[model samples]
Target: MRGSVEHSWGWGHCAPSPLLLLTLLLFAAPFGLLGEKTRQLLEFDSTNVSDTAAKTPGTPYPPYSLADFSWNNITDSLDPATLSATFQGHPMNDPTRTFANGSLAFRVQAFSRSSRPAQPPRLLHTADTCQLEVALVGASPRGNRSLFGLEVATLGQGPDCPSMQEQHSIDDEYAPAIFQLDQLLWGSLPSGFAQWRPVAYSQKPGGRESALPCLASPLHPALAYPLPQSPIVRAFFGSQNNFCAFNLTFGASTGPGYWDQHYLSW
Candidate 1:
């Protein structure tokens, strides 16, 4: 009877151990292991500027005098009405106008088509990320250039964005989802010269408080940051809230100039 007994030692005949089973499960569910893709949500080109200008009402008098040309006139040629219509129908009509409390307000959204399918539909955690890329070229006439400051408000509440409107009127609270970048210069550059800088920001509260470096092109116009790594991703996506809309404002420091060639991509 013993001579008739036999057993197979093949892989199919042996059941996997508990540890092996866990490894297989992990491999099957790799959602957390997948890397997030960088998404470009907006791009503003020369045509955008012209279109915005055409849609905006022209000022009877110059918005600013030559003495203070480095003030709100930086975007004089841009029409807020045109800009709002061109992008998403958010209010960004007056790039130079300020709120009653003095905070500059520029509310606009990324071009609708630029939205990426991979971006989460909601804001879940504190690690969501976004980026802004700008390239500005000034006219030939050089003068006392003005420094520009930018405040980007990515989330808001209300019928459209009442909270954003309120924030624009007051300087008291820093919007949790706001990203502020200061000291942008515009004016008098060589014909082919352009400054390209890309800044990435997190969507979490107090995200801007982190000491992230501002990467820019080198002082020499001909030199540039290594393309692949300049705008570094400082955080990983850990939340469900994706920045679907944006409010862009040019702050108190912007100057007047003819931006011959300007580009913005997000």
Candidate 2:
């Protein structure tokens, strides 16, 4: 077509180089919002690890855990039924004994229109269980953001994921299982005791009733510890090898939106 109208009238006599307009505005945005701004520059910052925990002793960080992930320019609207969870400092349904068994798991998997909107650093444990402490009790209740519309993209296919670069095969069966949350036996509970208030969230058990793997409960289990410190327990696991496999898409509201204004703007 005459070289596409002479390449748009020869670039209309030029005027666009700010590195070509910042590489055309970063290829016109959205690789899942640049992978959620590279996960807010790689998430996990529990008060900068408790303000350097007395000059780092065993600081591999991540105690009460927090990674809601919602790059709508910050949104923890605070009213999805607030309760405020706590532990070590008490009141997370306290029955004393420094918090019991502990259970509250909701980080789901189910919403597949063939995997809609998810693809960014779907990380969650694979480096020898970080500290292998079983992170006492269990809970996943904090606004329930739903891992930013979920995604378990196995960066490099499985069989212990060696090489990478396989963007979409729907899922490469939870790949390159590499988890390293550093670990100095991470344990924190200050500031309203971190998180996990409401309870009862279970799924991972493959008994074929439309499975929901790794959320919680399989006869009361949320990973255990605290019975003379020699105690142990693990309930709800279905698809081991460090379970992680995603593609639970659904996220759309870039510029002038609707879908009830991105579902009531919250």
TM-score of each: 0.17, 0.17
lDDT of each: 0.20, 0.18
Q: How many residue pairs clash in each candidate?
A: 11, 11
Model 2, CA-based lDDT: 0.18
Q: Write the per-residue lDDT of candidate 1 for residues 1-266, one digit (tens) a residue.
A: 00000010011224343233222222211111011111111111222133234322121222211112122332332333322211111113335342112221122211212222222111111111111222222211111222221212121111222111111222324233333322222122211111111232222211333212222211222112111111111122223212212212221112222221221112
What CA root-mean-square deviation does each model show from the true structure?
A: 24.8, 23.6
**Best candidate (score: TM-score):** 1
Put down candidate 2 lDDT per residue, 1-266, tens digits, no spaces. 00001111112234342233222222212121101111111111222233223322111222221122211211121121221111111123333332242321221111111222222122222110100000112322222222112222211112322111112233433322222111111013210100110111122211122111121111111123211110110111122322112222121112111121112110
